[model samples]
Target: MMLRTIKRLSSRPVHILGLSTYNYSHNSTLSYRKLTTSASSQTIKREEQAETATVKKEEPDEEKPKLSTMLNLDRAQMEKDRLARLKRKKSDDSHVPQAKHIKTLATQTLTFKKEESVDPLPEPSTSRRGPFMTLRDLQERVASYVPRHTQYLDGVVKKTYVEGRERTPNDIKLEEVFQKDTLQTAVLSAYVWEFLWVLQKLNVGECDLVLVLHAKEDEMVHHYRRNLCNIPRTRLCFPNMSGNVNCMHSKLQLLFHLTYLRVVVPTANMTPYDWGEALGTGRSEGVMENSVFIIDFPELPKTSATPDSNPSHTHFSRQLLHFCKAKGLPADIIEKLDKVYDFSRSKPLGFVYSIGGSHHGTEALKNGVCGLATAVRDLGLKTKKPMEVDYVTSSIGSLNKEFLLRMFRALHGDDGKISVQGIPKKYSSRQLAEPAAAADESTESESEEEDQSDNKLWQDIRSSVRVYFPSRRTVAASKGGIQNGGTICFQRKWFNSSTFPQSLLHDCQSVRRGMLMHNKALLT
Candidate 1:
């Protein structure tokens, strides 16, 4: 019975030390032995198999697949919600109102701030790194250097024509030139800062203003409104221009008085720099000098007829009307001036202008080079000799052989006789008298001969012509140096061209040696 009990105990699974031998009781005679029997072995194997199965099941829960991708869709969804909330908050805040006075001032301040920041001032190519300067600051700097009392217009008071190095004689301030109460209205045209400086110069606050400028319609209006808001009445006129037209480069002023209308054509712009303003100190002074042609036309009597109908209508008056008409000025203004003013006094002075257009036939003889021809003819200038031509200028265009030739021909009061379709028709009567074939052949031969003659004449004219401009050396050594010469430009491509007359080029040595010249003049 004891043996049976031992065998039964061994058949059951061992709890301690796995399957190792152990003595359960000290009194028992049966020796401990390995539990290698089939029943015991089967029981031990079944327990181990159950433990491994459990471990396998738990491992799958802890370990994850390495190739699996994590999703961030929820994060993206949260970010979108955050942005939507921010937009709603901003919209809600915008509906809130503020005090009226504070709001008005704030709005104006913001408007100006925004405007000032919109257009970035370009840094000059030659400018070095430094603290930035605003346009207003630059204007003040330029104005500071100018002499306070530049004009001494009393010619009889000053008999000596020459003033010392620092002083200028016979100077006239634009502001002092106009009579205060007598000035009724004014017309002003210039290159830069037209409204700002000119309005103060004229001192015609109550007068009606007619401003001619070159800019887009909206831009021009905005500029005028920004600068001249206090003016009582204003009119803006743009020169009639096409894509090929370069610029509206004329500077003119018209002042209407109680008894007369005064016209002043000046070589200077509205800026202080162009009107006897210097950029240097003491003896080494840089000056911008310009000349003016001023004329006063008397108001006609009421008994006289309109200028168009009157026999006394001078060439200058007719041309002025034509120019106004071409530039798209107010018809009523032109008519009023024509009817009221007598321009007979202006006959002694010649008005030369360049209006942009592709004019043909006889109409070509009315402006630009052709207009110069007309002026020379009217003035009765003798051009029979081989005339020497000298031209001084601040700006140079893309000059070519053809342009120089035409200019030479124009100076001699000739049409240049270029072969264009409509121009030949001006003398079509001569062609009509001959047979059709003969006329065509004769015209061709005549044109060829004329061209040869023109080529020969061009060679002679080219040799005699000279152009004076500020060279690099001249500009660098000036009182203001290269910075003030920004307005003068001549492209390298034009100068480098084969057809450019390089031999005739000369440096413009101003009388005031250190001063830069912004003058444009032609001498024959």
Candidate 2:
């Protein structure tokens, strides 16, 4: 194809191709030259045409200003254009409301039409009509089923009561002595969960609860956490027993009601077993029997005209208030007892409290063993010169000769006789009934007199006092048996001590056979 093209170009005239004759030496050279020249010219012509076409396609026929051009523009014109665009946009937007705006408008319209008004998503129902869903649902079910308040005599399921008269039973339920229909409760116990459970049974959950227990703070919180409803209303008080006191063993309850305040002093702990609730399954009789002393005080009249408004100067009332103060009770509750409640009814009652630490001087006459003497004296109870006192206790500490003598004297309202003649010189010197007898003997006759006096005192104590405790056999035979008798403790170390009055240890067994006795009573 190249040869044919070259031959064709060679036939053409030099003048037509616009090339000189001197440029070629031979016909072939001339033909090649002609082909080269003609081809080059044609390629150049095509290149120019392509460049022109591309330029025409890519470049605009006329240049237009950039939309954002502002180097030398008129400010007024730019502002005018911007304002016009905004006005047009506003008109467009006004024709169609936004989604949120439309929803708000619909809500307003429906709100005006009571019949067609939309309610919020309905609240979750509390009624048990639906299936059990959450734990709260189960709690509500349980609360509804359980009685809010129960009778103290409710445990006496064995005997039916007559309509007209109240039949007192040999064993009383813990709730029976509760400030009946109490508004609030303050419980002092050694146990936590069982006490809280007892409170639940008494329907005391509705009101505020002040729990003073000898339990760990975390344990108290854990127990109360089970009853989510009472958590807010319950307050736990752990006595500062970090001092001389070992534990908060006070078994007291202050039941506040609308009309009166009931003070309960019970030998029972705040446990179901102690409160007359039977232990183990299918047992109708309670494991232990306890005693309670309950006294009700009417609400003091608002007017000063009433004699009840004046706080009782009675020894019992003053001593009780003092005990409350010492225990760091709520100030408001103590005030209510002192001023808002009538203590005139409490006058005949005798109160005895044993504070832990040593009491000296005048304080000695109002606390511990001495306090018992004070109470007995204040009560004006008839007493023989040689009183035969029987002290029955479920929980007994180490018993010594000196302690028995002091106890005997307290019962006889003669706390002055706090010493034992034959005890160690150190202890005898501190609490000698006759300091002269403890002095150096000046003669053999004087020494004989001192010895005689000591002998007489020792004989008096032995004849007058009797301390009763449950024997191992007695505890084993009880309803709860040996296992549950852990609470009724008398350390082997104390029992084996040489000074222990083994002779005074009369076997204490409850009247109700097979039942343990938790009662602490003084039979004079």
Candidate 3:
């Protein structure tokens, strides 16, 4: 026992929980030793108290001002204020029922205010980014900078003309332009107001409105009802659909009555808009597009020929009539197209279409573009500075080198001077600058020997290819918004063979320059 005690004295003594190692003070030791409550909380409180004491000793003492003293107020008045606050808080607790009643009344009154006066609605979907900006913010403020596209949706709805831009949507005043005895009209569009508004403005009291079957048709119709001053006597046409994937993407205003047919193809769901309107500040105006209002009437030939003289040379009006008939159009309109309109004489151009989404992928480019190309070739017009064919559009598709090769081939053929220029409103400004440098390099790199290869036509077409890109503004002073520059490129080259009758949809990685384009038109 004596030896063990000696050993214990010589060696180090071990405290429970290694408290001696921590060098805990007496207060800390007591706080941790308490078993009735959590040691952690007690220790924390002790530490806090010690820190607060230290802080108090270190702080300099100055004359602290009371709320009343700071404002040069009297103590009695400050006391009264404190008492009033307490009284107000006590009253608040007692009058809870009345306060609730007042809140309910306030809510009811607020319901009467116009909704637009309220905060803007939450974004419809987090997934969707805003439509692509085509210009830099700074460029938008440049009064003289020409835009590739114009923002004319406001004009379309207001039916007012904005200066320094394209003609108004109702520039010709369709109501005044067309003769009496209104035509049997067939309108294709996604927006009902765009369709109905134009029809009403044209004095079309009765007509057919064609819609691509969509899930939100019910809501859209409800909204359209609010837009219209009078409910139009409309015959709605939803083309026969086998699946949800396909839609009637074509936008056309086909009117026929009493030996005449007129076709108006506008971009953006036939919204009454000006094709030549100047792009405003901070709007998409990087590129230009082509558009036209097509009007044609059946002309009787001096030589006698039946309405269906040759299926090959069937007039544009007749072809339109055929398209309607194939779709099982309403009997009344069909009757008018069949009897009233003559289809003997040929027009300068006709509308071409693809039946399904797959059709756009294949036949649309071929038939539509190639047909135009063939027509251009037939024109035999000579120009020293290659003929400039333009495409102004809103929609683009996945285009690739091969598809472009095919297209250029179809358009250019042996004609070296044919240069195709496209300006999609979304990428107008940035793409405008692309063609100059890229085209020169690309054209220089290719060899003429390749002309003898299988893709001779494509090679020839690539020779004269050029695209346009515009200068983007960096910032906008008026809106304080960052508008991004535009870009263009194609993804796939699914098209291998050039088909006749091209449906020209703009597509490219290298974009082109344009001035206030966006009306869907093919101008040769």
The candidate that achieves the highest TM-score relative to the unseen native structure: 1
What residue runs in model 3 are displaced by over 4 Å at the alpha carbon?
A: 1-196, 199-232, 240-247, 257-259, 272-290, 298-315, 326-328, 344-350, 357-390, 412-458, 467-515, 522-524
Q: Which of the two candidates, 1 or 3, achieves a greater TM-score against the reference?
A: 1
* Deviating ranges (above 4 Å) for candidate 1: 1-171, 176-181, 217-229, 278-286, 306-308, 416-446
Higher-TM-score candidate of 1 and 2: 1
What TM-score would you give candidate 1 relative to the actual structure?
0.61
184-241, model 3: which lDDT tens digit per residue? 4555444222342344343233233443322235564454444332323454555544
RMSD of each: 33.0, 35.6, 26.4
TM-score, candidate number 3: 0.42
Number of the top-ranking candidate, with lDDT as the measure: 1
Query: What tens-digit string does per-residue lDDT give for candidate 2 at 1-524?
Result: 01101111112211112111122223312121111222343453343244322322222111111111112223345345444543553454433222233235445644633332122212223333321134564354344431223222112122111111222453344434542233455545454335324543443324566767664355654554443332324676655565566666788778775455667777777767676665534355567767776666766667743433454446878898888877777777677777876676666767788766655546667777778877887788636476777888888787786676656656666533233122343343344333555443323354465456656767877777787888999998877789878778789999899998777788997666776777788888
Model 2 regions lying over 4 Å from their true place: 1-170, 179-182, 191-196, 215-230, 281-284, 305-309, 381-384, 415-452
- Distance from true location, Cα of 184 in model 2, Å: 3.6
Candidate 3 Cα deviation (angstroms), residue 220: 8.1
